[model samples]
Target: MAGGMRNLDPVIAVDGCAVGGEFQGKARPEGKTWLEGKRWEAGALRFCANLSRCSGGRRLSSATNALAATSRNFRQATRLLGLDSKLEKSLLIPFREIKVECTIPKDDGTLASFVGFRVQHDNSRGPMKGGIRYHPEVDPDEVNALAQLMTWKTAVAAVPYGGAKGGIGCSPAPDMGTNSQTMAWILDEYSKFHGHSPAVVTGKPIDLGGSLGRDAATGRGVMYATEALLAEHGKSISGSTFVIQGFGNVGSWAAQLIHEKVAR
Candidate 1:
């Protein structure tokens, strides 16, 4: 098996081991066969079982993994900063966790319900700011991770707002019975607690006081960031060519801004 694997592509051998553990079954070097006689299905099952065990005996969800990674990074960062242990613990914890059931009347005169979550991770620097994503995979753990990310990101960028994230386990598609209406619902419910505050949320419809530039804020920020870096090196945005991904909110705006700079 060892001799046969040596003949196989190194990448494939490494991938096989990563997925099925180290090869134990012998292979025929004459045929250049690797793991040919091994019960791959059984090995894969055993690998999954071990993976579950490592993740607290439950199937690892994306949200759980995301939160774990964020927490790990936060710990490492705090250690390097020589932060106070108590403060570090406090910073790692969320300020609030809100879960609500949103029931809306369907077009057919029936009621449909969905679960929503809002996790305010921290407010040490300023008011919390984040987006409310509407997706079926939205969960508390993922929202918490995003919120924590916002906290750190704002601080790093010197933004006056803190970090937060909210979402509902509902489709964002209109055909799926949810759309901007979902965001409106979230805003109303949140305002019931925080009062009528447009600043409390973003990515809202312009009619609801969402800035016309809201969708472009992220892209504009990226452009400005690039400009700053280039300026420090005695370069400028007008002299640069950029490759941006996605035609969506941030990417589109960044491209527009960069194009304008280049054209000028």
Candidate 2:
């Protein structure tokens, strides 16, 4: 023998790789590989072992590493492309942030307080345009991020629109009948500052002077795009199986259009 076998604890090896601290009595040797007998830190090996367990041993470790590498590559690419720090800082600024508190009477005849936020990110091109989402998670940071995205999206689309996003943080699921009332309250509150400029925001109810076709514009656009693509491929919208994922205005309209085509 080259050297006497040092009496030490048996290590726990997973997939021919030593995972962590040694396995003691009652631990049997499973198998062996050339990679064995290599020293590894207990913490690092434990982390790797936990990752393997979490991933169900389906080689997700490689995917995790790939994502890390991809992030590094993205950083390098940004540097290579000469990303403008000044432009990034300027774009990060929010044009305005509005916070309001309102009192609404509950079913119990008690007044409840609600806080709402509206963040206008930019208005370089024209009037600001965006949606007013109603969710409990609505916050200034989220509104700001979405408004910034809208600004960039409008710029990319070459639309004569700036960006604005607003919302009232409240639960919309509790009372379906009260949704319109809530929206009305939100509209009223918003109008105090923005005025009754229907064009400033889309998706307002018809009574609020919102554009007639604006509600289904996105769905109509999607349908048109799909029809053009199918026509190019010698296919028609009729007699086609359609699956819609969302139940929102756009998805609902798209489904209705497709269903009518299929019915005919």
Candidate 3:
């Protein structure tokens, strides 16, 4: 991440922790990863997680941390767009950061505690939307990095929602971890604070009014888009070489649809 900050102006300063911040009065020297004095203290600090390992062994926090990548990309984008300094800081900062303890009783009557995190980047578009992932390695820093990504992702998609991402640093039983059941639990808990609001989420079980074929909708949409683009060029997907990355839900579905069209 050394040259990652090369493109951005010196106005984007760094705090003691090396995170991005605003320069109060003096512009910090070039290539300085840390700052001192009240003039360079933190006023706003946030970055999208890089999540990819850099060339060197050095790390901001985690080995595969994401802030560096996200931050560098954002700075380059702001430079390209010629956005204002104030607006750039505003976009980098998140709207909210939340941490909570989730305790549950085990089958043997013992108790277990797992940490959870949710970072809401923005909601000015409409509602804050992101994924609620459950994994044992989930942590606050990673969650914060992901939230920043969600903000711009929604904007690029021209969606009406903002970016937000959540994750629990633990796993669940196989049955409860599936799509419908997980959504049902969320709906029930949310209803306790607000009301019976099924609209709060999507991908609920069909019994709970989840969208029909919701699981494969994204992949299907991708396939349709590809077909349309190919059609415009006087070609089709049939017998064409297609490079589909990842085997997740979206990729799998998109591949399936394209495969049906005899695409290679």
Q: Pick the candidate with the highest lDDT.
A: 3
Clashing pairs in 2: 10-23
Question: Per-residue lDDT of 136-202 in model 1, one digit per residue for the tens?
Answer: 7777887798788888988998988788877778775544322234455657877899898665545
- What is every candidate's alpha-carbon RMSD to the true fold? 14.5, 18.9, 13.6
**What's the CA error at residue 262 for candidate 1, in Å?**
1.8
Q: Per-residue lDDT tens digits of candidate 2, residues 1-264?
A: 000111111122232243222221122255323232433322211112122232222232323343244334445655786878676557567788889999989999999888887777788898777666566756676567557667776887899988777767777764422223344565677679978644443445678755568556755665665565556545667765444434455556666775667722
Alpha-carbon runs more than 4 Å astray in model 2:
1-83, 174-200, 204-208, 221-240, 259-264
Mark the 10 consecutive residues where model 2 has the least summed lDDT: 1-10
Model 2 earns a TM-score of 0.55
C-alpha lDDT of residue 182 in model 3: 61
Residue 173 lDDT in candidate 3: 36
Top TM-score hit: 3
Off by over 4 Å in 1: 1-64, 174-196, 203-215, 226-241
What is the Cα-based lDDT of residue 145 in candidate 2?
59
- Which prediction has more favorable TM-score, 1 or 3? 3
- How many steric overlaps are in each model, in order? 0, 1, 6
Model 3, position 165: C-alpha lDDT score = 80
User: Please, what is the TM-score per model?
Assistant: 0.61, 0.55, 0.65
- Model 3, range 141-258, lDDT digits (tens) per residue? 6667677887887798898988788877776534222455667777788889999888777778888878788777756766766666556545677876665434555557777988
Q: Give the per-residue Cα lDDT of candidate 3 at 127.
A: 82
